[model samples]
Target: MMYPPIHLPIVKVTVLEDRALVERHAEVVLSPGAQLVRVEGLSPLAVDRSLQAQLTGGSVAQARLHRAWKQKPREGSPEGKTEPRRRVDTLEAEWKRAQVDVQRLQSRVEVVNAAREDVLRAIAEFAGAGEARPESWHEQLEAVRASTTAAEEALRQARQHAERTRQRLVEAQAALAQGEQPEPLLVTTAELQVEHPTGGSVSLRLTYLVPCAVWRPAYRATLASTGGGESVTLECEAVVWQRTEEEWKDVELLLSTARPTLGAAPPRLVEDWLRLRDKSEQEKHTVDVAVREEVIQKTGEGGAHQTEELPGLDDGGEALTLTARHRVTLPSNGAPHRVPLFAFTAPAVSEFVGHPEHSPLVHRVARFDNRGPAVLLAGPVELVRASGYVGRAQLKFTGVGERLALGFGSEDTLRIVRQADVKYDTQRLTGRRTRTHLVKLFLSHTGERPVRVAIEERMPVSEVEAVEVKLLEEQTRPPPTKVSEEGILRFELAAPPRSQQELTLAYAVASSAKVSGL
Candidate 1:
């Protein structure tokens, strides 16, 4: 036996990076024995292979996705009329009536004008023929003058009515053109076959995946200083965009970073072969060297730099699933809607960071550990403090227990000035060239409270045997507190209020004559 299609309401939705999984539930009464059931009102973008159905009191024998073109009622159709359709119909009727009124009033004005012209012509003819006495001619002319005035008044009123009717017609036309559009004719539904020995009322759940739905991670960080201590509050959220043609109202929402499009099989491996060749006479006599900027690679939790062949969801790291804290309602429009996921507060260490070589302004930095349950994905963060919203920053992928730092806004009371001096020399006997650089940074504080600043500087690193680089420690004043192998120099300084401090750094880069560029 065949049964009518049942309308299922969406109860839950799990949105991923590129798609969404929708779950719907409904209860219906059915007769005994096997019967074919159909569920209607699904998105056309739903995947065929992802359809799944479950029956509580019965068993589902077979389920499949079905697509068909169902025509919708047009405007003014006898079947039915939507609200927007009704509005359009009413406006159209009004416009027609207004057009008729304008034409009628215009005809009246033309008739009145013609009658006045005829009366004036008759009066002029009678006076020219000298057919009446002076008193009679005067009386006739006076009567004609009064009749002409009345005709002109009638014409004016007719023109005014016509103009007002025309304005209403124009307004009606504009509103009709700007009315809301109706839904498309294409529809998707799911068909299922079920069997039950004694069926009465049963609850069913239908789940499927749909495309054109995506979500991305976003964050809001607020830094505040309380009487007890300073803390940073991080709120995690998801920005979802979907056009599934089905509204999710008061449904449980889940945001996941899993990429279902990725395959499980490992990539095919290939063999690597190396070839060597002897150098020519010129290559043996001289060595070539060039200076180029190095690209920095980020290390993962394993403390090793890794690269991916294709970009995955959430910075190409592990997958994470987060549930919304409260129920959400999202429309079918393809617009971004932010949904709150979770939030956490942690103790923060606030400081001022300066990079004089790059910018003269010092920025306030806050360092905190990720004490939340899930890893923080890389996304844009909105920065807020006690003074309200300051600016925005980008947060990188941070794992649990990992420390992360964010720069809020620039410090207005602190100022920095940088200067550099360079000197070059060549030794004729050794055929060697040397370049010396002297860098100076001047810091000033205008605030009443003292503040500590961390200054960062970079030095060149030699990658070839013909070039060498070293920091001239003996000539440099107040050496850097920490120096990494990657040629990063860090200095920590404490500045008193209303005071100025100067720092100097000197470095040398020596290269042999065989080197091409320095």
Candidate 2:
């Protein structure tokens, strides 16, 4: 075990898988009503471990948020590229580190709460876990009370550390949201302009923004002022938002009139603000805003007209319409007026695949090779067979990555389906041999309501490759209140009868990668 299991009077938690035991105990045992913040070291690990796994799946995964300690743009290191790092990888590592902190703080919280519970049980005259007289219970409670103080102090310090890290993360996030400069989210094709204050509205081309408000880019302002009549410097951190998804993805935004403070180290005119932080923005004037990144994205439900099981075929086809809305607050009007931008269509997945030469997000070489084994497919069931070599078989992959290659599709779907790709790391690169029992399923749907091809892992049998697959769960229609993803097709009505969705299941495993017999 990498860490110890946590125990508390209020919460006794045992670690499950990669989850932190203390946080689990708090949720299941202590039952704290207060909502735990999801920041690093705050939220429980169990919430999104699957998604976190995919973000950090690669062997070379790691996120590097530039620190002040890193020197100024030496020679080749422009805007901190001084070293460029993989983002999704870093986010995954950050999430893992955050989970560890969460476990630590939660451990302290659980211990303290358990001690508090002891005091209550003592005062309320309730029985302790083990038999104890009222006087004995009181003494036990005193002992617990003494320990609680130290636990409280420990929790406070841990929280302080987490908060400082959070501040840095926030600043980084904020800067990324700006979507400015070399860290380009989209390939810039045209020039644009932004209306500014003092200088009034000047020329700055619209480098990026969509017809669909999945990402509405707006010019931001950062003001710095001193009490005395000191020169008030100006800075702006761009903000990009998705109106439909109600999300703010991290995109680099341009920084104008930004400079480091006199006493600050590593002075650079511009820096990447991937997260938000408390910066010098006391006295600043309102500047004009530019919005873009909306596109019409229409999705088609049901499946292909055919029912033949095809390898790697997606039945939930979609259409995307790109459009943008502009809400401008001029010097004259207190209320900002809104206007609609033009509309365009994004490429469908099939189209993107068909036209690999044009599609921006997908790599041609990224293909699924079913060389391992086959998955079982019976009726509506799909599952991978059990393997003795590695204990369990699972896989995780991404149809796309974080940046906006943006021909079409919702980032939400990517977060949901492509985000959580979990496959067992059973196959060691060394000479050791292992078996992976995976199933391959081919599906085609031609129904009003898109169907879910439910899949489960089959347990191993004592003899040969024999295994039985189980029907775990199916998602025909997502919850009405669910956060709808653009990549997934939604069915407003119930699943119709007699509609067929063809499916073929294939399973595979890693028998041996080396030639030991030779």
Candidate 3:
């Protein structure tokens, strides 16, 4: 039986990385009788078991959702198949016209060829059997030659026109073929049979899990530093995309990271055996088989929509949830829509870092702590300094009170020149060798603002007891901070405007058996 269409407007959406849970609200005015109320406009990809209805001011003893494909009417139906049929008719007409044009051009080409052959035959007859004449014969021969050449050119032009017409016909035929495809049988409604006790203007909420809706986390970090406060500000944002064949207008949007396709059950384990291979074996056996399998299962209720506690979340715990502060409207056109989730500023220290072994350029780095209550998810972060957009970096999952360093870009105002020298000496009596290495770093800050620079240097760790390495404290400048036992030295330097500073590091390696690496 054909029932009246139910209008269900999306109310809330819980978006995951690749899927979303959609909820809709609709009010039905019943006549205080028992009847089947059908809810239309649900996603065709919606899980059948996930279809649920919660009613207020009424009680339902039995509830079931029936999904069926409804055929299109001969008249204008909601499926909108008339436009495609019209397009197919138009393409067919154009294709027929193109075919007629091609045929006409081909006929013209044949006529031109016939005329050329006739001229050639006339010229051959006149040259072979006709009597020898003077000026009149020469004039006639020239006329025949000119006519023959014109006829041949006309034939070539006609053939080219025919080819062009054929190409048009091919294109039109392809378009007509595409347009002639049968209209898909789409599921337009889900008839809900609810055994109601008593119904009177009930507000019904229908929730379902649909595929093709996804949301990903994107961040934007904007830095602002006056060079005297020793702190920088950071901002973050998110981008979401959905195409669930339903418009979420003025809806509460909640984003989560969940995998529904993997199902609630864990994966089954397969046995794997390890065997020793024979070095001289060169035999193999192979088998091939074709198999096709399909399994359909009803999906249970997905994750819930997150409302609060999103601001104080750390990287640990269960899945995180971020809710939009305001209502969001996303059409079912499969497009990316950006929404500002939250923005907070944190204090950061800006410094310049350099690695002389990789490049001579110094990169601007920002060391910031997650002082805010919200945990920043791992995603691509675009960095923008006070000057302009510097570069892009990846923001790993950071918890509260966790420190992170991000590279802003290369700095040209700070210049670093590194020089190194190595000398080796051997002791003949003990068969020991001493290798001395000295490194000099010249740092110049030409900018108008003073900056902090951190230089990282690496020292070789002795793997054997016969090798001993020592750092010369008298020759080194600026004490190291938090040096690791694995031979890593970090030095923090304060660079003033228009000033140059020199840093020296010297280390000696002594090995009893003359080590190859120093």
The candidate that wins on TM-score is 1
Clashing pairs in 3: none
Can you rank all candidates by lDDT, best first? Answer: 1, 3, 2
Per-residue CA lDDT of candidate 3, range 235-352, in tens? 5555777777678889999987654553456678999999998543223221122222322211111112222434322234457788887898888888889877877667777778
Stretches of candidate 2 exceeding 4 Å from the true structure: 1-92, 118-138, 174-518
Per-model TM-score, in order, reads 0.81, 0.17, 0.63
lDDT (C-alpha) at residue 199 in model 3: 55
Q: Which tens-of-lDDT digit does each residue in 376-416 have in candidate 1?
A: 87778999999999999877777788888888899999989
Q: State the weakest 10-residue window (summed lDDT) of model 3.
A: 296-305
Candidate 3 local Cα displacement, residue 330, angstroms: 1.9
lDDT of 3 at 238: 58
For model 3, state the Cα shift of residue 502 in Å: 4.4
User: How many clashing residue pairs are found in candidate 2?
Assistant: 90
Ranking by TM-score: 1, 3, 2
For model 2, how does the per-residue alpha-carbon lDDT over 1-518 read when each residue is reduced to its tens digit?
A: 01122221112111111111221112211112221111121111122222121111112122111112222233344444411233433554675676587678778779778767867766666453555577866687778877777777776776776666666666665665564334312111111111122332122111111122211112111111234421211111112221211111122122111111114366568876797666444313222222233333322121112223332212222212222233321121122222222222222121111111122122111112212111111112111112111112111211121111111221111111111122433334543343333232222234344323322212222211222222212322222222122222221222233343222222222322322221
lDDT of each: 0.83, 0.27, 0.70
Q: Which of the two candidates, 2 or 3, achieves a greater TM-score against the reference?
A: 3
